[model samples]
Target: MDNETLQAWVEQVSRDSFGRPFLHQATFNRRLRSTGGRYFMRSHDIEINPKQLETFGREETEKIIKHELCHYHLHLTKRGYRHQDADFQRLLAEVGGSRYCSALPGQTKRVQPYRYKLVCRSCGMEYLRKRKVNPAKYACGKCRGKLFIKMLDFVLEP
Candidate 1:
């Protein structure tokens, strides 16, 4: 969506979901490759990754908006807005927003917290991996069958 449309959407969502008005700008940032969207602390503005909408569609993008709104509203009200904050967690869960900022391409450091994982097609075993490996070249450790990759969200240390 264009900037004008995005701004309107953000404002509408703020009123509908949080009972607050979003006074800052909201625009799509093509360069945001690490997550679905972000709320700038300095500007109180919101940025949505265009890739997020291209990949995940409108519904998911709306969730990302909700996620960013949680940050915006909480921060403006002087409540907890950081991901680890109890207030942030509670508001996020209550709103059913994305638990983590969703990932994007070329953002390796935060791409996937677990560099690797193995899922057994037969037994459904999930193994967390810290190092990357060729999924096609490896077999499930538990079933000795083909394995699938399961990436985890990056969790910053408290």
Candidate 2:
């Protein structure tokens, strides 16, 4: 849906769920990656991630809207608006808002492979490391002996 539709939806949800009118703007933010929606404390504006509607449809998106509205209403009224606040939690439960947004599919954190390995000279204990480090500055934990560094082969993707 367009920004205008989203704005209307947010305003409606605010009124229905919290009995408060959302005077601030609401829009779909394409750059939002991990969050379903965000509430700006300074602007009192709410941004819903468009990907959420595309992925989870209207029902889930409404819950996200309610979640952001909880923050919006509570913050404006000088009450606890943060996730850890009791007021926020109680209001969220009353409105049936989602505690946390579902993680987007295929958005797992990237894991870097070990680029270097440290081998102890005496004990032969080896440790894999993501970054290169000076082995001379460190000693082996198994035995107080010298250590050496070796670069591990990385498989390049085409």
**For residues 26-80, what per-residue lDDT tens digits would candidate 1 score against the true structure?**
9999987667888999999999988888877887888899999999999999999
In candidate 2, what are the lDDT values of residues 77-134, reduced to their tens digit?
Answer: 9999999999999999999999988888998767777788899989899978887899
The TM-score, computed over Cα atoms with residue i paired to residue i, of candidate 1 is: 0.65
lDDT of 2: 0.91
Measured by lDDT, the strongest candidate is 2
Please list the C-alpha lDDT of all candidates, in the order they appear.
Answer: 0.83, 0.91
TM-score of each: 0.65, 0.80
Off by over 4 Å in 1: 101-158
